[model samples]
Target chain A: MKPLLDLSVYLVLGPQDCPGQDPVDIATAAATSGASVIQLRDKRGTTREQVQLAQRLMTALEPLNVPLIVNDRIDVALAVNADGVHVGQEDMDASKVRELIGPDKLLGLSVSTQSELDAADLEACDYLGIGACFPTISKDDAAQVGMQNFRHLTEQATLPVVGIGGISLANAAQVISAGADGVAVISAICGAPDVSAATKELSSIVAARKDLG
Target chain B: MKPLLDLSVYLVLGPQDCPGQDPVDIATAAATSGASVIQLRDKRGTTREQVQLAQRLMTALEPLNVPLIVNDRIDVALAVNADGVHVGQEDMDASKVRELIGPDKLLGLSVSTQSELDAADLEACDYLGIGACFPTISKDDAAQVGMQNFRHLTEQATLPVVGIGGISLANAAQVISAGADGVAVISAICGAPDVSAATKELSSIVAARKDLG
Candidate 1:
């Protein structure tokens, strides 16, 4: 599958309380509002529960045609028939995943270093997700890849590149200008009081940049 | 959970035609003969097929108390109730996986460089699966870490370290002498004609190191 050229926002859902965040609700809201890719990333849930949630989210986002990516889960993704699966630097090897999923399905790899990029068969993958642009509570142990790494890697990648981790509207443009094809936001969209409004504003940033070419 | 200390002989499965050997049958034979860890490393299946194979392998190996480590699918590992999941530098973040799967599950991360080793949090993981101690075709892009990198990382890790990628009984002692808790093999025990005998010899090597203290 050819990767989308527009900036894709990955909505991160943290559980309720610790500052009033809701993952499913936020993702639903983001999808309805126009987030290109709505990925479910709740790392702490039973397989049954995670699959059910992914199914519901896949159904919820169907109308928008916004791809639902199950974070680090091939089973849940396959069970839910999600649009794709997002694996990290410590997840499954992308080439192996591509072989398992076939060439038509989208398989994304999280790369934090140049060696990983060199190691991957770019032809087999749809895109590369680079991240933690800023430290975020979503993944505390995310490596310090920094914005420069983002720019360099994205520029170097043969496939589309999505920037993840702690991304918000405030820095989305900078990440895009840094050469990322898309920006995957977690807390920024999920935590917004009005997800629809937040997505509209974020989407417009990517949409408005078409004239830059 | 504390890792099993006495367990030895890491066996990996490979494809039949490639690398002039078959990894799956080798791994199966090794498991039947009492190998400690049997890893399914087929990088050629789709997500659905991979999960199915993992499920089948888990069922096959469960009776022997042999831990089945999936090459890189935490979701598949969780799906199959696999003993654990092994990942490389291009996979998911190990700490994130620990959070997703909880502390009780086993999470092993692959390390090929001193930088990656130094960056990883020793406390978050159950063990370190280090490797490609020599050149081999089990993995197409196997990065030869040389003996020095192996020695350096294993010495620094507080957790049990398993050497992987092209490890054979011929030089299994080198990995152990370097402070590795175990050595992971791909085509070694898996492709041998007398699988049981191959594993027994490898196990003895891992065992003979008792005098190292």
Candidate 2:
């Protein structure tokens, strides 16, 4: 049931020049290059080595079950119980990480403004990892909310935003025609030579704009 | 030589009701009851038990030297390299926590609004904790910013705000005359029966309101 949320073309893999790509080989090469949602931001390990690399990237995405999110360690996403956590606007406050990753998990919140996406609460989140959008070499980015702040925060959000930090595939359909419901990248699938054809050309350009109307 | 920044009072002691309280006995009982700065919120350990309770609350406040903030575990405040890390408006972007707590650490971000303190970056922080100020039993609240948003984020801040949830001592000098430079508490110094006379009655009503201004 929670498997159909295809977090829409999102991918962020960096641990320095893909240093022999790990997190279960970058979540099995960004879930067979259609990168739906696989963030394992490795800020130099040790929560028992990021919960043994989020338990070998949740047992190598247990055959593309695709949902291994764990960026800012909510206790190594509750000690390797990964599948939720992306917090950043300065961390821990989407109603306290939805009361410590509970209400059916998967809480993400890395917005860039529009007053922290209207001081975020978005019903204790399920999505909204907004962005750095343009100014990024991957990191050391301070402020750069471009793509016209993704059509003014997906035309005033109601949850489900994605679009994080310097998305690629040549501006990924101009950030999904400026109202992203998805598009997050880190050096386009960890500086791809071919992370499954750059995540199947940004998931077939977000599945051919999945009814953007 | 860092002790004068003590904006009155702020405390929170609950790690199984204090006994040899960690984070240097909840920051030397909030700097011997006249607390200037001491944020050590340990949400049930293990980053090696909150880096050995922030290295035994930074060695029991290294001879009462105050300033020891480490709430959202930035690698246990850079591994007991405590003296800065409050983060929350949602945790890591007061300029990437002032670039991983650099430029001589001490970041603190949490502003509720006034457009996240006017899209804060107010020189990448040194203060601005603001808060719940009134309605809080505390399990990580995120939408209460009242008391007229403490006179509109204290006339649209310039940093140095610190008002935190449910402050006591009967609303502690009306949250330091609603321009708060300090007034943080958790059931007034860990539900005081005398946490140093409730930290000297909220530090003598925020130092007798500078003789009522």
Candidate 3:
């Protein structure tokens, strides 16, 4: 069995997400406030740069007891011993990742369409991130799954589901109420003026919803 | 102790090296014609593309008994279970790479300068690739080590040496004379109209030099 992951208010970030601010600082602040986990989704840059950043993030998040999840690059995740690795529809095959990362590490897979959800290997994944819960611009190619579809998928998912893409304090409560175990955000906290404040608000909403659940 | 390597003629290739030809075909033909080893040094494309290419190359070279070495990307090398991984002085640290690859996999490091040679962890490396034998245009940043420096460095190396970068039939003999255990080439074989013929000539030169020694 894989170790438990507290994925509530999961923060997804990258160099592209943080242009003026430091990602480590943002991640640290987000975790301190209420982010349960963080994913380093770097699409561009050399492997050396990615490794250094992941190492720093892992060290910073260690004391906070927050998991540092890496996106796409399994090597970086393995090199730094990140808590888990997250892959999308286009990334490496989830089964290969599970084999390389071994049984102990957490593995998360993205699901949007009914086909993708149906095809996902639940045994290999610790959690499933389902959404594009709203239409905002973190990713250009994200498959849009609004609140109704998001709720429908979350209900059918055997594994824990984290609603991602465009989630914020405004709709985080709705996401949780709709049956999602957590809400994963990219720009919500990282792009906010007060990263900690944004995280705190989202966490409260999740807490309130969980109390009712 | 490390396993004895057959370092007669090593072929280094990437998509950039093969313009009109397929890299797998070139590597396969080169290995059959007498290239002792092959390294997939891909610099462009997505990790998906790199992994697929590496897997194909490994399968193609396995029957020929030519070891496939992946440069810079430890994940691709690990994903495909290639014979080993090769990194340059500017790539991942040799010690870390050795730890990730574990003891059995072949690890090769690029040592073009005396300082690099001095700093190299010989205990962790199966071989050292030293070069830029005549300064042709395979890589613009390659350290240009003419015959004299090549001989000097090759003689000083405790690990087996494969002279790489800009090496071809004309100067492969000279590299062998310079005490290199093998010759690694990019454009020489991959770019040749007849890759097998070019590899055969280089292999013969290396074999003749070894017989004389």
Chain B vs. true chain B: TM-score for each candidate?
0.88, 0.34, 0.96
Off by over 4 Å in 3: A1-3, B1-4, B134-136, B145-147, B211-213
Expressed as tens digits, the lDDT of each residue in A1-213 for candidate 3 is: 454688778999998999988899999999999899899998876777888999999999999888888998888888898888999977777888898899888999999988899998888999999999988798888978889999899999999999988887788888999999899999889889899899999999999998999
Error of 3 at A123 (Å): 0.7
The sequence of per-residue lDDT tens digits that candidate 3 reaches over residues B48-139 is: 78889999998998887788999988888888998888988667778888888898889999988888899999898999999877787878
Clashing pairs in 2: A90-B91, A90-B92, A91-B90, A91-B91, B6-B36, B23-B57, B24-B57
Candidate that would win on TM-score:
3
Q: Write the per-residue lDDT of candidate 1 for residues B15-109, one digit (tens) a residue.
A: 54225544445556787765888777656654456667787777777776778877666766766667776767755567656665667667778
Ranking by lDDT: 3, 1, 2
Those runs of model 1 whose alpha carbons end farther than 4 Å from true positions after fitting are A1-213, B1-7, B14-25
Best by lDDT: 3
Q: Tens-digit lDDT track for model 2 on A31-146?
A: 87677778877666534456566777777875787887887677566656677777776555667566655777687877787987888888887788777777787667447787
Which candidate leads the pack in DockQ?
A: 3
What is the C-alpha local distance difference test score of each model? 0.72, 0.71, 0.88
